[model samples]
Target: MLTAHTAEGELVILTRSQSLESLRERRKQESFYCPQCKEQLILKVGDLVIPHFAHYQQSSCRNSFSEGESPAHLLGKSQLYEFFSHHTPAVKLEPFLPDIQQRPDLLVVWGDTEVPVEFQCSTISTSLVRQRNAGYYLLNMLPVWIILTPQSIQTSTADILTLRLSSFLQFFIRQIPNRMSVLLTYHPQSERFYYLSPIIHLQGSTYAARHLTLSLHKQTVPFSLPSSPSQTDIRELALHYQSARRKYLRTVIAYNQKGIHNQFLRACYEMRIQPVQLPAWIGVPVQGQEAFRQSDCEWQLLFVAAVRETRKSPDQLNTSFFHTFIKQFDGEPDDLLAACRSYGDFLREERIDIYRMDRFTDGDFVYEVLSGRFLAMYAKN
Candidate 1:
């Protein structure tokens, strides 16, 4: 909101180079109005805050430009404006897109394309994200969303990072062509960017990832993303994934109430197998398994047991089998169904015989499989 309209409909932008006295003098000379709502705006000339335009308390603007803007948000917007301005003269600060009724923090025109950039600092719902993206899609312009790194966000090392998969973070995860799926975050104060690429789900909200950091000066309009995880990094993640799986097994053993209502425990009993003694393949991670609140082990073990009991070849399993199998789990069925299919595909590819689980019980072999799958899943060709 650094730009506003004058009484004569002239757009005036307040720059940081302007002195306090000049800003106060300009405020006294003429009235300022919001470009989007056309409502009279109060030009706040303060020493502490960056001078910007504000709407009245009673204004009913659909844009809502002046509401809930934090200092970090304001400073970050200004910084990005300057950053983009360095590369392209086509960049604009707080331009109102009339067709969509949304005003992005900054807009940059790349060739014939207009890209609306959002510098998000606060937490918002996924629905809001979808709404904004939908608005941009109406004009066939893809908006670029850059998140401000939280003060609480931590990095285990320059290369290793672990994050809780909050809904907010999930919304920022991007899967780009020729690169890994990544979450991009920026630190406004330090002008640093963090790229968490090839993020993998361990269990629950926990994700294991490796990141690349770059100073703002070293960045471009499109920015640089880190390459996919290396084979060594994939091995490290496999170790972490295996450790989490072991911990889950321990928890299952200690917490099983042996009640008929406990479906996982009942499945263990029906299989005539102790929870701790389940084969290594029963609980392995899959690409879409994050959708399940149940442990990968519980549902996967149940799946293996059901397939074994049917005494059917892997090719014999069809849509009806998957549909009936996923009915036992809670939540949305699509991702769970996909995960089950992926597991089935892996079994078929490896020529694994579910009836002879005894041959595939070696933990070392399982580890090797986990590591190899991870490398294939994430490492760049």
Candidate 2:
């Protein structure tokens, strides 16, 4: 805790000017109390750590001290409060919201807009994150979740950062321009904010993210969706998709002890289709399809197989077929629909007459390749 109340109800903050000797002198004469609970607090001044107040061992002040509130968390919270307070006088530190029964790390009010800034320094469950987000939404407040750095992520490649996707981290994924989603984190030690944009789910619990670091002192933190993808962004996405596909294939092949266990591979073999050299249109990357359990290549192969089946009876391309095709996999309907639309766009580029139907009442529409010429036009780019 940075600020505490004295016995006279006077607020005393451990200022930067105060050294160990000064803190020791002040502690000898004045008594401190927890700002939230109004319980007595002891001041500790040490050479290794910052000067702060701590509740006594037997104290049960849940309101004053949260669970797992480490020294780093305390320091980060204080620094964030100071940062916002410097910019706006309306900033309040740890303001209790009666309606939601939650106290955000900091609340900044600007006219009609109230932003609850949460500096998350620890890993938390997705349900808790959703509950908090839902609570804020119900109160008509935009909650900003800023992940505290160092522990939140790790550097992967020259341009990528790997973030372990917890439910908390997933809540922060924002879709930017050019059909890419990103997560943001703040590093207080360096006074820099990082954006892990265009994040691609590599496999379970991990994502390959393109990193963008911004100086907190220079740039305002972005709260809006980013603009369209650049050529470089698209190129990076292509590379990531290809690499992910290769990795997925290697794992499947290694695990197929009693011959290929995957039904998709068996179907491909019957059609004499090489898994790695699927047609260009088959494995193209689509925006917002990360919810699908299957890899991009796997889903694309399934779609291609559907196209081949439809060629047998063109009139069979209807709502029932579409629903059955999608039901074969475990994926979000909305995400599958989005990927279908993207696939339709690719077909148009190739001069194929595939159309995405929207009249279906069961769910969102699916794409249909109009002619068998779609198969003959296939080429590996």
Candidate 3:
């Protein structure tokens, strides 16, 4: 086998153990050979299939067959399995399902017809014939057949440990794509292949050494199901529904404010905030404060509100303060101010005092924030 280097992108080839050992011995151009024929081999920087070899054209000597391995071949089996499992329909292509028992080299079921695939490149045997002929009678499945005619390897490199039949003989006979391709983003660094477009009847390969990747220009199957919570299941959820009547009641609800609630929670994340039930929920605060185990509820609420800078503090509000915080259009610089003003306006109507801060020009912003506080407090029982 020959090897060509200086190629772009990433590639790894498994050479012989002695080849590496000899390079350390002389560290110079040397002779490697076919393990079978002992003929001289070639090695040069080449294309995608690197360190390639060619016959000398004078002798019939060449690489025969043996156990070998290749990075591409390994990647092929993996990608092929995943692709088939995901796309091959269990219903439409029921007959072709792989048989775990009496496993043939390769099985193909086109409708009820079965065929056994085999390779007859350098060697042929009666075992292959008997296997293919008696495939389904013994295994009850189709016999899909395949063969390989490998080229003879002649090399001059003396330390040719890289020559193994395992290197090139990949066992990837999978169902072809019947749909379109899903154009996925291929990131070689991470060995990731992300599909964006749906490619039909796709044929591709994947290599996962340090990274996961699928060979591009392959089929994409549209094989997925959307799973959503059913309406009945949603109605049965106890998180917000109180009763059967509430579940059945039809109402026009616009927008869930969970994200807003989450934002407020995010702002107060570091303040050691706790959830508190409203006085109404506890049957007038005196009825259920013990289960919560805390006093100074109003003070904590007020302090936490100011600290989060949510402008929800029930301190005081004036129309000018509202103007400072409110923006006419969405996402203006003063939109945060508007948010603050909106909270203040809501509070003023609820009996907070009236004061506005425009420009402090002297003190910290928190001082401006906490200057006015709600005098009334909610004490935990």
Candidate 4:
């Protein structure tokens, strides 16, 4: 912990410029204690790591809230607290909330409003992230989670950095124009904030992202969170989607020699539908549909088949049919809704007569793929 209570009940914080000799001398004069537990703490002044206070190895306070704080975590938290304190005097470090039974790294009070600021340095589970956010919301406090960038980020591609997504990382995804939502992180070493925008998931545990950096010290204007992707970013994502689709098609064809597995591809071949030659509107990327385990091409093939069936009998396009179709693939209702919206956009772009259901209810939707001539034209196009 950065700050600990002394034998005189005075809070003492070790600074970076403090000499080891001086720290050792101070430790000899006064006993330190854990601020959270009031248990005895040992002043650790080391050559490699930062100077801080820690509980004794056998102490039960080792499991307390202030325990296990890494040097980088402590430094970052202290820096953030200092930054906020410069702007307002209402900032408190490691404030415990009795109602929520939780202690945030920093709590800033503005009139009746309280904001909980969390400096997250490690991976956190999705459920825990949601629980924390919910708890803060229940207390009428806006919870802001700031991520500490990994050292690997220094050598990563400037525009297209890769990051592992946790539930906490996913929660901060802000939607921007033309591209999908993105995650944000802060590099304490550089005192810079990074915006990992428009992330494209590539297979498992990998993503291609475009990022932007801003210096926290030189900022004259208030930071505005991006809400949309630029045209250029959208174009790049479209090209990437095309490349991924081609790769998926190649994999499917290579493994379909026995014709036992990949029934979807086999059906496509039997129906004289070349996977690579599908309509442009088929493989369009939809925002927030990354949770679907199926590849883009697979979902696109399903859409093509649905359109074909709808063209054969327009009455087949209804809520029940849509639900049944989506059930064939593993995705949430939100994913299905996003796909529906993407399909609607495709129809409008291609000038097709397929009408999307304007009103969507819990158990009902109305998607009509009318105009067989338009479907024929789309097929040929």
Q: For all candidates, what are the clash counts? A: 0, 5, 68, 6
How many steric clashes does model 2 contain? 5
Writing each residue's lDDT as its tens digit, candidate 2 over 1-381 gives: 667788998877664556789889989998998766778888978765567778887778764445347766666676776667666657776666878888787788755588998888787786787888899999999888888764445343356544467756776787654445778787766766777776776556667666777676654433434334454554554566556657777676665555757966875675665554444445444544576656666776676567666773223355565567677767677677666555545554554332222112121111122111112342445
Winner by TM-score: 1
Instruction: Kindly list the per-residue Cα lDDT of model 3 for residues 52-145, writing each as its tens digit.
Output: 3333555455222212323333233223334444544421111222343233322333344544433233334546455545746565644433
Indicate which candidate wins on lDDT. 1
> How much is the lDDT of residue 224 in candidate 3?
32
lDDT of 4 by residue, 35-60 (tens): 77788888888876678778777777
Q: What is the lDDT of residue 370 in candidate 1?
A: 43
TM-score of each: 0.85, 0.79, 0.18, 0.78
- Model 2, residue 5: distance off in Å is 3.0
lDDT scores of the candidates, listed in order: 0.76, 0.64, 0.29, 0.63
Put down candidate 1 lDDT per residue, 140-159, tens digits, no spaces: 99999999886645344546
Candidate 4: residue 371 lDDT (0-100): 18
